[model samples]
Target: LKFVCLANDGIDEHMVWLIGLKNIFARQLPNMPKEYIVRLVMDRSHKSVMVIRRNQVVGGITYRPYVSQKFGEIAFCAITADEQVKGYGTRLMNHLKQHARDVDGLTHFLTYADNNAVGYFIKQDLVAVWRINGSVAMFRQQWMLRTFALRRNSQAESKNVS
Candidate 1:
């Protein structure tokens, strides 16, 4: 799978993929509109990325400024049914995480994912911070310091051994 960071230029394609995602969600959660899905994908305030396999979009994610006033929220993340379990989701997530730190200059990252994605986020080391009854769930900010420290320590250990 290939991942690309996109701007408004990709909104049309994104809306198509988002409609697919919305259909999947609608199976479990009723009353989700295509306009809401389109807004989630086309909204300018959010930064977005797309994952493609063989030139066909398979997954995408978006991040927007959070209500916290300090951290950015991962507004949306969706992988096509066929693309699930193939590591595309993980790749898209890592890409988003890195973008938050490097491009957005955000020290922390946040998200509100459903039960299906909660485990994936947890596996990525995102801590669950809050849950809004049956409707929404929130996760806390991801810190890059620990990752840098681990990489630095590994490099030092390698140099010492060499």
Candidate 2:
């Protein structure tokens, strides 16, 4: 599979990739709102990296970079259900890290992982960076050190939101 980085531009291929990514997220994250997914994925401030194989989009990640903060917030990451457990997720995350560092000048990544996704994030080597008073579990991976940390509130539940 090849990774296609895309933005919410007027380009035709990018528009197609965005639609495919939206479909993947809709199918993979059944609990999340489709409208919410569409809004974020199509937002100009957010960018996506789609995993394309055989000219079809199989998976992707949507992120927003905070250059001033030296980090990028991962809003949504999903591989098609059929494509799961095939190392695509790992490779996708690696690509995002490279793009964040080299292109976006980011040093860290921040993402909120729900219970169902906690394991996946951990396996990606992203641990809990910190715990807020709220119920969300924020996972962070330091690019330079390649370390992960996790602090979470198990009592609280949330949709797969950023």
Cα TM-score per model: 0.64, 0.80
lDDT computed for candidate 1: 0.54
lDDT of candidates 1 onward, in order = 0.54, 0.73
The sequence of per-residue lDDT tens digits that candidate 1 reaches over residues 32-137 is 4555655765676765677766666676776675434546766666776665888887787778767666666665554544544555665665543333233231
User: Each candidate: RMSD to true structure?
Assistant: 9.7, 7.3
Write down the TM-score for model 2.
0.80
Residue 97 of model 1: what lDDT?
A: 65
- Winning model by TM-score: 2
Clashing pairs in 1: none
Worst 10 residues of 2 by lDDT: 141-150
